[model samples]
Target: MKIGVDYVKVRRSERLIDMTQYLLDHPHDLIPLTFFAARYGSAKSSISEDLAIVKKTFKERGTGLLETIPGAAGGVVFTPSITDEEAKEYIESLAERLSEEDRLLPGGYVYLSDMLGQPDLLRKVGRIIAAQYLDKKVDAVMTVATKGVPIAQAVSYYLNAPFVIVRRDSKITEGSTVSVNYVSGSSERIEKMELSKRSLKRGSRVLIVDDFMKGGGTVNGMKSLIEEFEAELVGITVFAESKFKGERAIDDYNSLLFVQDVDTSTKTITVVPGNCFDKE
Candidate 1:
């Protein structure tokens, strides 16, 4: 081991920096220690020490989790996460934005298209959602077309998983599509949605995300599509959920914001932190 301040020490420091970046870039991916050892021209022992430093820093910073697997075929995986405090803070801010009187629209609809365009906010929301399900073995993210695309993309980015779009209209491009019928949450009218057969694999763990859910009928439609594909429903998350009266279609889901009441007469919208903050 060469340990001069100007030589091996500098290289070690550089290695740690680069290794941390690599792990962050490839979240939820398993990387073998041998690969790191060869890449840095250092022994496995040195790589392990470097990872220990990274692991500690990540934990303390509330950045994420570093999981190490031992044995011959073992490797390390980095999974993104946020502290409860951070999640609550961010969601509270989001709820405030959604609660604005100007966001209220005709027929009690809340306008949300503008917020989806903000990349920074989406990144935080994605990290929060992805972090909550890191242990669920999320293989793919699913969402309905149009509004939910951005949310799904953001979550998939942090989860290091691909996203699939379920469309209102079937396209010839996506061959052999699987379609499902679901009642519209807002209107209570039956509507059809479809997804490409080739987009998801059988038995794969799927995380469903959406922009907004009212009565949860649309989400239930996606759940039906999951069943048709023989994929497992890991969980569901939504950016916001409007107030729904009576029984909802689905029972379990997490949301960043809940629209408690939207009074069109007074143009007042009541928004609050969703159930994801229940433990807090």
Candidate 2:
């Protein structure tokens, strides 16, 4: 409300706070200088100066990258990012928490539902994952059925893209749908998943996300669906992955945490940072 009001100039500190908040709210969006100037009833030169300060702080604090594109058709775009060191440190701590014995489930799956349901944690995870594919020009985020929906939604928020859900069964509400049959990682049974025909268009660049992985069959199935729609696979990421004994169905993907071992008899779980930080 203080912005874009009756040309009443605001204080420098107040303007900076509002401006930073605006940019944070609209990550991955292009905002023109004129828009900021009009919003705060300030001069273009002053707004530019304010942006410089915000950019410096963002960089120094490892918050993200703010880019200024010059010319009439260009504007400022903010990409939410985390420093490698910070991301590694955070992920390591997360891995540590997951290593607790109580986290081990009956079938070697780690209990991650509590963490997945947390908004703050999910937002941090989103920032870490979104930072990785900022340059991929992702049009949408994809996830299968119920469990992966939250992770997909979180990542989509930072990417500023819509998310599509793939269902285990085709729903009548979906109208016409596309289905892919994949081997179930846990049960090793062939299972089918469906996506709405209108969820994605041909040539759409999609990023797939999931909460966890064991045999990677589900993700592989999602990849097949991407091919079916003539869409591109920008990337695939999972929150946690178990140490699979058999050959995995999907080889190329990223995970935040790797479950090195899950001993149900001993009630122990060992978690470590996945290959996400290995690229660094």
- Return the TM-score for each candidate structure: 0.95, 0.94
Residues 1-280, model 1: lDDT tens digits: 3456579778888998999889989998899999999999899999999999999999999999998999998989999899988989989998899989999888889999999989999899899999879778888999999999999999998999999999999888889999999999878899999999999999989999999999999999999999999999999999998778889999899988899999988899999998887744
In model 1, which regions exceed 4 Å deviation? Answer: 1-3
lDDT of 2 at 121: 88
The TM-score, computed over Cα atoms with residue i paired to residue i, of candidate 1 is 0.95
**In model 1, how large is the Cα lDDT of residue 94?**
88
lDDT of each: 0.92, 0.90
Candidate 1 colliding pairs: none
- Candidate 1 overall lDDT versus native: 0.92
Q: Model 2, poorest ten-residue lDDT window? A: 1-10
Give the alpha carbon lDDT tens digit for every residue of 80-122 in model 2.
8899888899999999999988877777667888998899888
lDDT of 2: 0.90
Candidate 2: Cα lDDT at 118? 91
| lDDT value, residue 262 of candidate 2 | 73
On the 0 to 100 scale, the lDDT of residue 247 in model 1 is 92
